[model samples]
Structure formats: C-alpha cells, structure tokens
Target chain A: MEDVRLLMLPGPVPLPERVLQAMMRQAINHRGPEFGAAYTESVEVLKTCFGTENEVFILSGSGTAGMDAAISNFGKGKKIASLVNGKFGDRLYEIASRNGDATGIASEWGTPVDLAALEEALENGAEMVTMVHNETSAGILNPAKEVGRLARKHDALFVMDGVTSVGGDEVLADEWGVDVAIVGSQKCLAAPAGLAAVAVSDRAWDRIVEDRPYYLDLASYRKSAHKEPMQTPYTPAVPLFLGLHESLMMIKEEGMEARVARHHRMSASVRAAVAAWGLEMFPQLDEHSAYSNTVTAVRMPEGVADADVRGTVKKMGIEIAGGQDHLKGKIFRIGSMGAVSAPEILATLAAVQHALRKAGVAGVGDGVEAAAEVLNP
Target chain B: MEDVRLLMLPGPVPLPERVLQAMMRQAINHRGPEFGAAYTESVEVLKTCFGTENEVFILSGSGTAGMDAAISNFGKGKKIASLVNGKFGDRLYEIASRNGDATGIASEWGTPVDLAALEEALENGAEMVTMVHNETSAGILNPAKEVGRLARKHDALFVMDGVTSVGGDEVLADEWGVDVAIVGSQKCLAAPAGLAAVAVSDRAWDRIVEDRPYYLDLASYRKSAHKEPMQTPYTPAVPLFLGLHESLMMIKEEGMEARVARHHRMSASVRAAVAAWGLEMFPQLDEHSAYSNTVTAVRMPEGVADADVRGTVKKMGIEIAGGQDHLKGKIFRIGSMGAVSAPEILATLAAVQHALRKAGVAGVGDGVEAAAEVLNP
Candidate 1:
C-alpha cells in the first residue's frame, strides 16, 4: 500500500480529486474550440482572483517564468527598484537586476520593506518597482498596497510577485495600482505546478518593449489570445491546463472571498497552535507586514534539531518545510494554502505536536487542542 | 455522449493511457528524492531519444522555449545563418534575428533549403547555423545531416529543431555534429504538451553566454540538474513531467529502432494512400531532403475546398490539419506520429476519402485499402 503522505509545503499544495481526474483525460487539440473555452474561462477566473480588469495571460512555465516575463517585458534597460525580504523577494531582485538596471532595497528576512529606501530610489530616477506580495520563505505577507501607493506616487510601473497570495489572500491589483501581477498554479490556486498567470495593466502594456525573450514575450501572448479560438502563443502543458481549469472552477464554486477567509482561519489556527506550544513565530511583523495567511513559519525551539521535529513528522507521513538558505534548521513552515481544510490542519498539527514531545522539548503544551479551539470557534 | 475524436494533427498527439494515468497522481514535493528520481530517469531516456551522450535538460515550456534557449544562449551577439523553408524554420530565423546578427537563407515552402545561400552566409563569417530537422508545417524532413556537415566545415555551431523528429525518426545528434538538439513532448514522445527536452553538446556549452533571458537560461538548468536531487532550475510543470516519464518509458520499451521503423511504415502508408487517391504530395523533395515521416502534407484536390473536406471529416469525429499561414486552404496534413497504429490510420483515411467523395472530387480511389496494404506489408 502506498503511504498517504500529507504535503504541507508553501506551494504545490495537494490538489483536489476532481482536478487530478480532469488531468487523466486523453489529449485534446489545443488549437480547437474546447481548449479555447477552457483557456478563456481560466483567464476570466484569474482576473477575478487578481482583482483586476486588466488583461491576463497564462504562460507554460513556473512562477519565476511569470516574474521573468513581467520584468523583461516592461522593466528591461530601465531603472528599477526591487525590494528583498525573503527568498522569493531576492529572486525578483535577481531577475530584475538581470533584465534592467535595478537597485535592491534590502530588508531583513521576515521584516517589512524599507519604504524610505524605495522612495529614495524612485525619486532618484527608478522607472520601475518590483515586490513580492507574500514571502513564502519567511511566511511574511509584505505590504503590496503601500508599495503600490509609493510606486504610483513616483509614477513608476509596479510589478508584483503575487505567486502565493493572489488566490489565497487579498490582492486588488487595479486598486493598488499594480502594473503587472503574477500567480502560480501550484500555490493558492490548488492546481499542479508549472503554469503561471500574469495580469498586465494598460499602462504596462503601453510601455512594454519588443526586444524580449521569445517564449516569455507578453505581446505575442496577447496577440494569440485575442485570436479566434483563443490559444497560448506556444504549446501549453495540456494536462496542467485541464487541471487548472478544474481547480479554477472549484475556486469559482467556493467564492474567492470565502476561500481567502478559509485561508486566514487555517493560518490563524496554526499560529494559535504555535503560541500554545510555547514556540515563537519566525517573522517579526511590523505595522506594514503581517503573518502570511498561506503559510506559518515557526522558529525552532532551543536545543531542538530541525531533523528531530520535521524528520520525525515526515516519518509519520506528514511533510512540512524547513527553512531555506541562511535560515536553514532555524525554522519550519506549515502551509495552509489551496484546498487544505480542518482535517488536514488538525492531522498535521497532531503529528507535529507528537514529534515535538518525542524530541524531548521541555514545557511542550497541548498545541493540537489550541488549534482545534481556533478551528471550532 | 461525448464524441470520441481522433487527433491527426502534427502535435499534441493522442496520449497513451498510461501516460494520462501517470499524470493523474497528486502533486509531490518537487525538491524531494521522489521527484529527483523521476526527473533523472526522464533525462536518461531523453538522452536516448535525442541519440546523444551529451547532457539533456527538461524545460517546463513548449518546444519554442527550447528553441529560444538554444538560440539565445549561444547565438546571442553572434553571426547566425538561419535556414527557412517552413513555418518553424521561419520562427527559428525570427528568433535568431531578434537575438543575434542573423541572416535567413530562404527557400519556397515545401521545398529544400537553399544550400548556396547557407554556404555563402557561412563563408561570410556566420558563427552558427539553425535548421528544423522535420518541418511539420510543410511535412518535409530538412537535410539536418548535410546542414550539420556544412556548419562543421566552417567551424560553426549547429542547432537542430528536432521537435517532431527525434523520437520517431532518425536523429543522430552526436554523429551529425549538432551542437544543440531540441524535442517537444507532445510530438513524437506521446506525452502531454508543455514540456521540452534539450540536449546540448559541450562545444555549445562553452560558447553559452551569461547575458541571456533569466527564465530560459541553460546554465541554470545545468547547475540545478547537477545538484544532489536532480531538479529543474525553477518549479517544473510536475504533471507534464510525470506524463513525459511514462511516455519515454514506453519508447524505451518499444526500442527507438522499432519506433522509428513504425513511424516510417505509418507515414509510408499515408503516402501510399495519397497516391492511390490520385492526389499530389505537397513537398517537392530534393536529393537530400525527404518527406517527413511524422506528418504527411497533401495538396488539396482541384475544385475541392479545404473546409468541405477537413470540416466534413471533423464532423465525422476525426481531426486532420490544414496548411498553415500562406499554405492555408492549399493543402491538408495527416499526422502519423506518436502511438498511432493501423486502426487510427485506417479510420482517418476512410473518413478523409468519404469527405472527399462527398465534396464531389473525381478520380478518388480506395485510399483505405491502399493504406491497409502498406500497413500489413
């Protein structure tokens, strides 16, 4: 019998059974009406999730592909300000620097972006601003609205990496003045990994250049999408698209407002459990920063090895994520994104509590009960 | 009841049952050993399909992504001679011209590349050469070996777009001195569309530059693939990778030689049917160039409308391809690639014959019988 392992990672969250079933169908002609319907429907749902009336296009790559397209299309050869607070933030900075003349406005991991520095950069001729809405690496949700305001004030094009936020959290792209926003299928959308959906404001479209990478070119995508029987500029991952369509339908069934609320409740339960366990949360939040509603990061207790807790939980068939890069072994994250519910959250919490007690962590409390109370309440 | 349609287009071919089943599994951790093992196995099989000992990397985009990477990585800022005889060949030239100082060596559609033009460009200091191995658009297999030889003679790098050829046709990348070879999953591999495999020779690797697109960077793919658990640089389209793994395994089970022979026999049957129907083959092959074994393009009969023939067949639950771009309505294409066998071929031919007869075409013969004779013989 196969071990039914629970995936509790930040992205690539467990898919719904219907989404998996949708992917099992035989191949369909991508240039035909059936695919066109699915593609157009997915784009419609994506626009709602992005909270934008702007044009949205799907790319056959990861979230990074969407990020690359956003920057390369509108930010290339321009002065840009990139904010870095965690792994994904740094990735945006790197991609921005590679494509344009970018300046990194550094902030500590799990901390708020340096607003003064961003304003300084923008005032000093930064033509674009790049930011990560939800930093999954540190489980921090950055202030996208504030940053968008600053960018709008400076008359700079704003590109937001909403990979883990759009479908699971609140993201009003047009209201926030975001020129471009990106989301990954495997994150809050509850679809399998690989597809990236990007929304582009008319402002960004007017400024987008022609000299860009062929595969990630946004203009080509727009052109092909407007054709009869809408299609991608290149061949899409057909199965993944099918899965995404199904998942997006599910999202529609459970309205985006309800889904975001569920995510908030789930993450709050995990935080309640962490507080009950006498464990500290990883991210130190400021007024403009908050705990991510998709994933909760908790610092490793004193004298407890990361392997002892995370490995022990893994042995019990529950998989969580350890800290990446410099924060390795210092923290563990529990994802509450996608279609995750009370049952999965409770099961994961029970396993984590058992592992923590088994690892001889002193003063361990009833974390599961605390989590259950939050769930029931 | 849903209509069961047979896809006879050049790509997004009908997937095998096992491949679809493989893609139905729930998402797994992409950074874990399970994904690593699957990715490693897929790469090993891709090497065999590509017919090279050189390193192969799987990308999460379409075949165009591979083409973009192949050109932008090594051909940027260099002098490139792009051979254009079909739509795909024109695409290569377009991409090359966008990235490098490229010159398109042109020929009419459904005809061989102009060798003299290519030679002149090489003699005038062209540093790289690009050709499409199997031009799916025109159903003509370009002379990759001859083009590779010419490139080698001039000490230039050779890049072959083997998108529709590598798995089902003969593509000896190393022996042909191809510096870079790319294949599409949906073409000959019978996998879902969206994944592309690229095999890169060391010579090309040595010439690859740093200043290229971030998402399609080959160096990043190489670095990530070499890590402990083999992985793509970014989050891969996980379900497509699973489907590709199953399809590649099926190819290995059938053996490349047997697969190529099957493709040759199938396409020969298609050609045989065209001859029996008193229709003309579209491409005028040169001494070196030959009709493509993956797809067969046939000129539409005089006084027969493309919509009348193809649309009628499509109404009968069958799908064949019409000519692209300028060739639209001038010819029709039949794909005999992927896992197609006698049943599919016979059914498609029967429908096409019925459509043609209904459209008032004279001199129509028993094409199904002719195809069956070739299939059995």
Candidate 2:
C-alpha cells in the first residue's frame, strides 16, 4: 500500500475532503446561473475574510496574476514605492518595476521593512506603495497597517499581498486602508491553487490606467461582475472555482474568528516545539514586525543540513519547506495554515524530531511533547 | 436525485471520468518532482498534439491568457494584422490592438476570413498576423494554412488560436508554419477549464519583446521549463495540471488520428442531422474555409423561438449552447469535441428533435435516426 503523505508546505496545504469532492464533479456551463451562484458565494465569502466592502475580483491565474493586476491597473508609468523584505515582497517589487516606475525599498530577508525609508519614498513623489503583508518565504508578517497608514498620509494607493495572511491572520483591509488586497486560493483557503482573488477599493478604481494588460485587466472584471449573473471577464477555472466555493463555505461554517484562532494556535504550537528543540527562529522581528501565523521559519542548527531535516521528513511522508533562494540550507519552514489541526501538527513535529535524532543531532528535546502542551491546552 | 447533465457546449464540454478523478486528490508541492513530472508529461503530450518540435509552455489561466501571451510577447509595438470572423477572432483582434499597433482584417460573422484584405495588410507591412484556427463562436474553421502561407510570404509572424482544434482535429503547427499556436484545456482536451498551452516556434522566440507583461510572459515560462523537471515560472494550478496531464494521456492512448476521426465523425453526425431536419448550417464556408470538426452551428428555424428549442432541451437535463453576442437567438451550437461518443451525441440530438416538434415546427425529420446512420455506419 502507498503511504499517505502529509503536506506541510507554506501554501498548497492539505485540502479538505469537501473541497476535493467539489472538484470531482463534471464541468458546468460557466455562463450559466449555477456557476454565477457559486461565483457570487465565493466572492461574498472572500469579502468577509478580507474584511472589506470593496469589489473583489477573482483571476484565473495564480497569486502573481493578482499582483500583476494590482500594479498594472493603477501603477503603470507612475512612481511607485515597493517594499521588499523577502521573496514574495521582492516579487511585488519586480512586478511593480515591470508595470510602473518603481523604487525598491530593500531590506534583509526575514527582517522588518524599513518604514522610514518607505515614508521617505512616498514623500519623494511615489504615487503608489506596494508591500506583502506576510512574506511567506521568510515567515515574517510585515506591518501592513503602518505601511497603509504611510501611503494614505501621502495620498498614494496601497497594494498589499495578503496571499498567505488574509484568511489565517488578522487582515482588516478596509481598516488598514489597503487599496488593493490580493489572496491566493491555495494559501489560507485550503483550496487548490490556480485562482487569485483581489479586492479593489473605489479609490483605487479611479486611478486605473487606460492601457492595461488585457488578460489581467481589472476594469473588465468590474464590468463583467456587474452583469445579472456575476461573471469574470474571461473563462475562469471552473473546477477551481467550485473547490474555492467549498473551502470558503467551510470557512464560513467555522467562522472567521474561530478559523484565525485555530491558525494562530497551530503556529504557536510549532514555534513552541522549535524552541523546545533548541532551535532559533529565522526572522528578526521588530516592534512593527511579527512572526507569521501562517508559517514559521527556524534556523538550522550549526551542524545540521536542510536535507537532513526537510529531506528526511519528506522520506517519512511529511513535506515541509526549506528556505528559498540564498537562504537555502540555512532555514526550514513549517506551515500551519488552512484546516491543519493538532494531530497534523504533532505528527509533523514528531517526524522532525525523529529526523533530527537520526541526523546525529545531540540535545534534541521532546519537541512533540512541547507542541502537544500548547495544542492541548 | 439530481439529473445527470449532458453538456454539449462549444467548449467546457463534459470532462472524462479519469480527468475529473485526477483533480480529486490533495494538493502537492508545486516545485516538487511530482508536479514537475506532471508538467513535463503534459507539455510532452501537448507537443505531440500540436505536432510541433518547438517549445510549448502551459499558462495557469484560460485560453485568453495564451492569446494575450502570443500577441504581447512578440507583437508589442509592431504592426499586427488581426483576422476577425467571429467572437473569438474578434478577441484576438482586441488583444492585438491592446498590445500592438493592430489592424483588423474584417469579415462577417460565420463567414470566411477576408483573405484578400489580409494579403493587402501583410503587403502593407504588417509585422505579425493573428488568426483563429477554429472559431468556436461561429463553429467555423478558418484557413490557418493559407493564412500562415500568406504571413510567411510577407515575412510576418503567424499566431493561431487552436483552442478547440489541436486535440480533437488535425493541427500540424510546424508544418503549417504557425509561429505560435495556443490551446485551451477545456476545449479539445476535455479537461476542466483554466489552463492554456502555447507552442512557440524559434522564429517567434527570436522576435520576443524584452518588456512583456509580467504574468503572461512566455520567456519566463521557457526559462523555467528548461529546468531539470520542468516548471512554470510562477505557482501553477497544480490540480488543473494533473487533470490536463491525464486528458493528454487519454489523447495519446486513443492516437491522434483516431481522435480526429472520432471528432470529425461526431460533427458530421450533427451536420447530417441538421440537414435531415431541414436546418441551415450557420457559417458560409468558401473555398478557403471549412466546417469545424469540433462544433457545429445551425441557424434557428424561422418560426421557432430559441427558448422553445434550446431552453426546452436544457430542461430535459441536457445543456447545449445558444449563440453569443448578436447571434443569441439566431443560432444554436452543438459541441462534439473531446471524449464525447455516439451515445451522448444521439441523446442530445433526440432531445433537440423532441424540443423542435413540441415547439410546433412542422416537417421535423428524424434527426436522431439520421445522426445514428452517420455514427454507426
């Protein structure tokens, strides 16, 4: 018999049975009323999760498509300030540079964004500001409220990548003054990948460019959404939309407050386990920055290698993430987002402990027990 | 119990059970070998279906995304001649105009493209030429080979939308000198909607623009595909890729010749049924144009209301398509693309015949018997 693997990656977490079953059905007419009802329900749930009353559009591409739409729609040929602290943040900067005249406010990965630098850029005529609320690569939650505040002070549009944070963390988009907020289906929603939803404020709509990318055009989405049956401008991934609707319904059933609390508790359990194993956290959080509730990053021990930990765990049928890019082999990340509970977390922790011991690491404490303490309590 | 639906739309046809089952699994790490294997397999089969030795990249959006990529990548800032004979043909023109300086070579809907006007545009120094191999909107197969020949003579790039043709019909991209050929997963492949694949020739690659749209950039896809296991540059719709891989495998198992023959026979069955019922085919096919083998469009009878025909059939748990845009009540389309066989086609014809008789249309012949004659003999 094949072993049942557990997925613990930052995004694309294990999907719920409901979501899976939803995709198992046959194709439906995308322009029909049935698909429209599903689309409407998913959009309404997304608005609740995003904590916004603005118009939210779902793009058929991944999270990057949403980021591209966010930037290209309103930031084209305009001076934009992009804050980069990690891989996803750097992605926003890259997309911004491609669409607009962008200035990157770079900081070390797994660290807080330089707020003063962001403010200075805005003051120096940056008309738009873009940042990632949670940098999944570094497992650091950037200060979205502060960045939004600074952008608002300068009367600049603020675009935030909430791909990994919106559902699992506290994201009051309207309260934070986020002009455009983006989320991926596979992240905190525990749905399949390939769909990205973006919430656009009315203020941001007024600043949209006339010449925008055709596939990712936001204005076209708006026009289509206003039809009798809500529809995307182009053909959406119908199965993904069905799966997303199921996942969103699950979220609604559990309630956002309960879901966020579960996510927070799960991440806390993993952090506790890491500390118990004498591991250091990867991110250096400041007053404004904090550890991400969706995923946690830990520094590898002095003598231990990433393959020894993450690779070994993979052999044991549990998938964790190693650091990306330059941080490879230096840090490992544990994702606690999207329908993960105490059982999955404890099993992952036990696997990691076993892998560490097998790697000849001394002084490896009872990490599973430590995690259970937090999870059970 | 809910009645099982028989979907016969121009695209988004009923998915095969194997394809639907493939998407019912849990999410996997997209950057891992599992996803890479799936991506590589899908791409390989796509090359076989496209009959090309050139590189084919899969984008995580719909067919429009591929169209956008084809134009925006090489046609940007160039003079592009877009051939428009139907809705999807007009879409190519729309995308071309958005990304490049484009002139639409116009022809009436459901009519052959104006080859003379297209030749004139090419001689007038059009840098790129875009055409739809199968215009699904009007169920007309445009003359891609002739268009490609003209474009080649004028030294213009040829971008063809083979969305509903490649898997179900004959599409030799390289033989036809198609610079870039695009296909949708939901169409001829009979997979779920949301994914698009583009085959790019060496000539098209050499002329690709440096500053392209961030999400739909084909160059990045090519770069990522060159990696060990092959990958899309961004996070792909993992489940959709799995479904696509399975559908492509089914195509391979059936053999391209057999699949094309089946599609042709099914469309012929429909056309024979239409002729027996005394209905007119929608498109005015000229010497260079031909009837599509993936879908058939028939003009509505003069006395019958569209609701009395299509709506009644739909109520009987069968979903065929009415016309789009101005063709709304003027024509109805029956899709025979993908894995649909004699049983489904006969059922749909029977339903339509029943509806036509009930709508008080006189001299309604035995469409089912006529279709059966074509299907069995």
Q: Residue B31 error for model 2, in Å?
A: 1.4
lDDT digits (tens) for residues B156-199 of candidate 1: 99999999998999989999999999999999999999999999
Of candidate 1 chain B, the 10-residue stretch with the lowest lDDT total is: B1-10
Residues A145-212, candidate 1, lDDT per residue (tens digit)?
99999999999999999999999998899999999999999999999999999999999988997788
Model 1, position A140: C-alpha lDDT score: 95
The residue-by-residue lDDT of candidate 2 on A1-377, one tens digit each, is 12439989898889999999998889887877888899999999999889999988899999999999999999999999999999999999999999889999999999899999998999899999999999989999999999989999999999999999988898999999999999999999998999999999999998999989899999999999988788888889999999999999999999999999999999999999998888899999999999999999999988898999988898889989999999999999999999999989988999999998899988888989998989888
Candidate 1, position A230, lDDT: 96
Highest DockQ scorer: 1
Q: Report how far residue A334 has shifted in candidate 2, in Å.
A: 0.7
Clashing pairs in 2: none
lDDT of each: 0.93, 0.92
Q: Clashing pairs in model 1?
A: none
DockQ for the candidates, in order: 0.75, 0.74
In candidate 2, position A315 carries an lDDT of 85
